[model samples]
Target: MLRTTIMGLCLAAALASPAAAHFQELLPSADVLPEGGTVDLDLVFTHPMDRGPHMQMEKPLRFGMLREGQTTDLLPKLVETVNGGKTAWRTSIDLKEPGTAIFFVEPKPYWEPAEGKYIIHYTKVVVDSFSTGEGWDEMVGLPVEIRPLTRPSGLWTGNLFTGVVTKGGQPVPYAEVEIEFVNDGSVTAPNDAFITQVLKADANGTFSYAMPRAGWWGFAALTEAETTMKSPEGKDVPVEAGALIWVKATDMGKAP
Candidate 1:
């Protein structure tokens, strides 16, 4: 019983907190078009502020992108209300002209976390930008083959999910693989209702799963060392199953 309780706490701790910023910055979808010029937006983060003898950290303020997503960090724009008074911090951009406009915005710290080194809620945006990712195949120095495998027979909830985890052109053995849902943070601890499934790589950096559920999914993972760094501290750390690689499984014949 003691062991089970400890394990349960560990699992809860891991999922209880979020690690680093989801994506370093508000990544832009693609290279800025010639027509795209310097863009500017707002930045805001929420926190538990005490107003009366009784305090509540419930409401969330609408936010806008304040800077571009880049390796460099920038100043943040924080709007605060104290004693029924409102205060704000705003910043601007000068993509100046078009042509080769590489807009890089730094993420500013809006608010400090009440307990941890970071704000309980870490949020940011890029004015009019969106971003996605494509990893490098370092092994042989090429892009790897990342194909969704054919569905396994006699299964409905999940299909055969096979993908290559390569680096510098070769398979990354022992690399962890995972699938998770894209969280639309409407409320805190939103995924608490759903059970997330996980998988690991083999000596060949291959992974398989019986599918955590019959629904949309995203795939993500990192090298063992990298994964360790991202794991949160205090209580049991939560495992980070990366972005879901959306998949659909129409049936589950009889998951054996």
Candidate 2:
């Protein structure tokens, strides 16, 4: 009876633990390009805080870049690759003019058996070339997106990042937002709570977070889609549509 009681207690504790948050990463080689050059992008789906056990990412439904109020198709440029022993993608873009390149991806709906739902995260990142910083606030017309109230680029550590959670060009009031920093094997979390920071948007659909470390930070505003999708087992399930935006923070130090 004691053994069974101990086993039951362990099971209960495990069920109450928080799971690591999943983030779709759209990272660029450089957030700011002083001189025009090619910028390489890494597309991966994984838990940024844990930094391992990457989930396989299939070919995205759409991949494009928005600059100067124009969208350019980049799906054909994606090259399949492996990251963390899982399927991922890589692509590069050449920028010669002064503009803000907003790269975005609409990944195919991923089925999460553990969550019993389909996950689709519309991920994007801003890369400024020649430091023009123009059109940094332009929207890419994603199904779900985070409209940045604060400048997404040219940010220093400890800067407060603010954005509005929008779905179909409208604000989503009191949405839930998850924040995670891309762990570079430097800092360790004390416990599961430190793995992913969670917060709710205000009534205006706006949320903010101050980045403390110097690295890539991803903000994911999650919500349920109005439509449901058929699971692999022929059962309809809810969809977890996420609007994710990535920003880079640099330390205040002299340039080499």
Q: Best candidate, TM-score-wise?
A: 2
* Top lDDT model: 2
Pick out the ten consecutive residues of candidate 1 with the lowest summed lDDT: 133-142
TM-score versus the correct structure, for each prediction? 0.33, 0.95
Off by over 4 Å in 1: 1-147, 151-156, 182-196, 224-244, 252-256
Residue 25, candidate 1: C-alpha displacement in angstroms? 14
Model 1 quality (TM-score) = 0.33
- Residue pairs whose backbone atoms clash in candidate 2: none
- Return the TM-score for candidate 2, rounded to 2 decimals: 0.95
1-256 in candidate 1: lDDT tens per residue? 9999999999898767643232212222222223345443322221111111212222233223222222322343333333212232344444443222222222332232332322222222212222121111111111222222433112246456566665544667776654443333332433533323446777987776555444333444443222222214443222222211233333445322
Model 2, residue 59: distance off in Å is: 0.7
